[model samples]
Target: MIYLPLLISITEVIIVTVPVLLTVAFVTVAERKTMASMQRRLGPNIVGYYGLMQAFADALKLLLKEYVSPTQANLVLFFLGPVITLIFSLLGFSVIPYGPGLAIWDFDLGILYMLAVSSLSTYGILLAGWSANSKYAFLGSLRSTAQLISYELILSSAILLVVLLSGSLSLTVNTEAQKAIWYIVPLLPIFIIFFIGSIAETNRAPFDLAEAAVIFVFFFLAEYASIVLICILTSILFLAGYLLNFTFIVSFIKETEPYLYAILVDSKHETILSDPIIEGMVYGLTLGLKTCIMIFVFIWARASFPRIRYDQLMSFCWTILLPLVIAFIILLPCVLFSFEIISSNIHLL
Candidate 1:
């Protein structure tokens, strides 16, 4: 039975990974097409079927390209960098509940697991920079390391708010809590902070200091891989990844049955329309769509904003975002406690 479950997990990983990888591939193509259209230029029309196969062509190109290693580079660490990044990036999906009880391995410490895995990905970047033995790569790596570490603080703080509000570290539970109102409304500031941190974490435009290329298209694939992971994580965290029903339902549920707001409470147990497969599909699709949109916004930002200086970037996070986030963390509990006190007084009256 254990072997069967393991086999099933392997199969599920293959099933989920193939589609996601394909989507990430084509997203690049679609992004280029969209950008080209905006600039009034013909995009990849020469490839198969309006350039739909262009992504595949690009993949082939990359595969065929020489894996050049600097003579002084630490070959083992340098190669391990991308492998570590790719593995950690994919590991996060295991806990991301696509639907109720539909994840690959739903655990009690799902959120914490994700945090640990995400933090592990930073070492890959650090290794890449240090291994390369190039001035630009080292600088890029330093910037990336500092940026990820600092922004991770803000990210974890924001996620901690959700964990506190929902009172669980499980992704499914978190999604269930949002069935009434997405956490975004009550935690809008955290949402914004998380989003900014995500962009920085992925090293997207305005924060792409790590792989910023003045002469060469340096580590472009690795950079995009990081961005893809950030997009996935963003969907998993803030957007309520497999949860359906809107903010109105969440609000209604909270107003009427406040006590039943646990993460996986299943308040609508009496509803007739319950299908696990269908539910899983819906949740997966919802998550996939949200991720796609987030990735689009990432590309849009890259197109729209010029990159900031490294000092300005670090200053913004430490001076502005970090302080604001700290303040919110300190204040949120007090506000909630005050509200509870006021409610209790009214009832006593």
Candidate 2:
């Protein structure tokens, strides 16, 4: 029985992880394509149909290359750093739902778990940079540590607002609360802040100082994995997770012309859509589309904006974003009280 449960858990992990791994591979291709389009240039087109297989080709090339370590570097920590980073980056996916009840581990404290896991990725980065024994790598790690720590405050604050509204720390509950309307509608400002914080947390442009000293392919893969995970998280927290409501359109069509509605919406449509397996597939697909859109935004921002100076990046976080986040933290409760819209589910801290 114990072995049975362990086997089931392993299966669940495989289901969630394989898709994420494939998506991370293609996200690199998408990044190239998006940047090329933005710059009005051609992207990779020779590897496969419109460069579809370019990511795999690149991965192969990376695998074939011999790793050359620095003479003075700590061999153990140097190798261990990227492994640690990749492990923690992948760990966040255990809590993130792809559809209803579709996760490796869906616990009540999932949000907290995600936050804690994400914070640990920085330690791997710090270790890798320090172990490299290169000044550039060490400096990059220091900047990343400072940046991640600073922006995490903003990220947590923004999530706290969502938690307040949803009255649960679980991402599953967070998604359910937005079934009628996404949190984005009411919390647009907070969503914007959250999105920015996510970008920074992922070490993406214009805050990509962390990648300046990349030493291993594992580091690269780990970063991309983090990007996809963060994008999915953004979609779940802001958009309703896989819950689309087209009832208004259907109702309007039915009211206008009953015959047309009967022709357009038939038993087959209902049967296919209502089937549990099909419903789960559709929900999973919807979530994938949402995640892809967020990933594109990350690429778009990278291509559109220049990397900010390290000092400017820190200043923006501490001086501007931190203060704004603090103000919202104080002001949100007051607004909630004034409107009597405070969630009954919120536990007093």
Candidate 3:
């Protein structure tokens, strides 16, 4: 029995970890290709058929590179920074349900668990900045930290709307609640608010401070890892995951191309995905497809938008997202009551 449970856990870890790592890989390639397309150029066609192997090549390069720690730097925290970053960034995915019984950890406090894990990455960034013993690194980390804190508040406030509407903390259950009608229809404004907050939370373009390319790439992976997680979460929360109530993921992908490109361009979303096995696959595919669209938006924004001033960054988060989220949170109950959609009162704390 003990051996069986251990083996099952190992299997589950493989199930969740491998696919996510692979998704992050292709996300890098998509960023490049999308950026190239934006500039009216081709991207990564030489490296293995449209640069499919580019991400893998980049990974191998990073792995082979020597660790060059500064002599004056605090070695302990400096080294620990990446470890902490990679861990917490991947850790948040544990609670995100991918499909029917697809979650690694389907606990009642799943949303809270993700929130807590997500917040912990800040320390990793802080340590990376402070331990480097470089003035540039310190200033960059300060700006990153400020962006994290301000946007995280907006993220949480937006999540509070989900809690009120769904009346459950588990993402799996919340997804089920949206089977009839996706939350995006009723709460489109809040959805947009959360998404914009997600963009800032992941420190994509505009909010991102331009820094040295070498070290910034390391920090980029860490932040972008969380971006991968949040993108998936956003799909589940607003896009209705596998239920396919609204083929928004595939629909959004159609924007960048005639059909859904990148991840799930496997032609298009078929409406007849009714079989359980097929439903699960479609569900998982839809989630991945939606997340691909989200990631593309991340890269698209980076390519198109200019970096904003720090003061403007802080002001937008507080003045715009905060008040809007608050208004929505207050208005949500009235909407639910009027629509007669109120469910069990789950703890919003």
| Candidate 3 lDDT tens digits, 132-165 | 8998888878887878888888888888888788
Cα deviation at 193, candidate 3, in Å, is: 0.9
Using lDDT as the measure, what is the rank order of every candidate, best first?
Answer: 2, 3, 1
Quote each prediction's TM-score: 0.83, 0.94, 0.86
Residue-level lDDT tens digits of model 1 in 1-349 = 7699889878999987786677667887888987787678888988899999998898788778876788999998888876776678777767767777877788988889988987998887888888888988888787788888988898898887777677777878777767667777888888889888888877778888766621122245545655666676666666777766735565676678766544423666432224566556667778878878888888887778889988898899999998998899888867866766323322444
Candidates 2 and 3 compared: the better one by lDDT is 2
- Candidate 2 residue 317 Cα shift, in angstroms, is 0.1
Q: What C-alpha lDDT does candidate 3 achieve relative to the native structure?
A: 0.80
Error of 2 at 275 (Å): 0.6
Q: Which of 1 and 3 is ahead in TM-score?
A: 3
Model 2, position 209, has a per-residue lDDT of 81
Task: Give the range where candidate 3 is weakest over 10 consecutive residues by summed lDDT.
Answer: 209-218
Model 2 scores a TM of: 0.94
